[model samples]
Target: MEQEKDTKSNGDDVSRLEKYKEELIAIHHKSQETFEQQLSYISAGSLALSIGFVKDIVKDIDCAGYRPLLGIGWVLMVITLLLNLVSHLLAVKFYRKSISEIHRNEFVSSKSDTRFDKITWLNWTCVGTLVLGILLIIIFVNHNL
Candidate 1:
């Protein structure tokens, strides 16, 4: 009976480990997908703002004396774009590291465990920056109008 209980306990541990690994993989995939979407949207918006709206923005600023506000808004949007890119890149880096660790059956260190948290922090920072950027742009446009 003692031997049997030990074997059963070992089996349960293996089962739990497998489940944990699956959860980690799922979270990693979701993070990657979310970051990609953010990066793409920001990249396209920034490009459009720069290329399609520059002449109009300049004309509006010349007429309205909101040059400083427009400049600040544009700068904020650039910062948002950069933050998203950095977050996406770092997520990819840490995701690969996680997969490599799993494949090697290596023990996870405390530092390695914090990678996910770091990723989350980066994502939130990107989002907050994006919101601030949009607010600046809105203020600029309203002023220009």
Candidate 2:
């Protein structure tokens, strides 16, 4: 009777452990999916905003002649900004998700480590795009005046 009781307890523990693992996996997958959805939404929004901003820049000018490059500059800037936003949203989302799952998942650390590249690259892209945009606007305005 004593042996039977021990065996039953051990089996219960094994079953519980497996259940916990399965739960953790499900949680991790759900968390990852949420992040991915947000990433897609953000990417789409950024692209739309960039396109609109560029369209505004090149729409019309008071200058005697149309500045061809004004439009192009805005275009480049907008594209860069959108790309940077994409990188940033994805990187940050992935990092946060990984941190949240660190306790249950060993792979979180590896995923977190890879986000640095996205961060740095995104930073540069945003900076370059903004500068280009400002320069282009100035050029267009000066020429129009």
Q: How do the predictions measure up, each by TM-score?
A: 0.67, 0.47
Tens digits of per-residue lDDT, candidate 2, 1-145, equal 9999999999999999999999997996686456445544544444455445445753545433545655666576557656665765786687677767786666555557666566666656655665666566556555654
Instruction: Give Cα distance to truth, residue 74, candidate 2, Å.
Output: 2.1
* Candidate 2: stretches off by over 4 Å: 1-66, 105-111
Question: What's the CA RMSD of model 1 in angstroms?
Answer: 3.9
Question: How does model 2 score by TM-score?
Answer: 0.47
For lDDT, the strongest prediction is: 1
Superposed on all Cα atoms, the candidates' RMSDs to the truth, in angstroms, are 3.9, 9.9
Against the unseen true structure, what C-alpha lDDT does each candidate score?
A: 0.71, 0.62
Worst 10 residues of 1 by lDDT: 51-60
Residue-level lDDT tens digits of model 1 in 46-131 = 54674355566545445755556656666666776776678778877887897798899884877687987887787777677666
**Worst 10 contiguous positions by lDDT, candidate 2:** 57-66
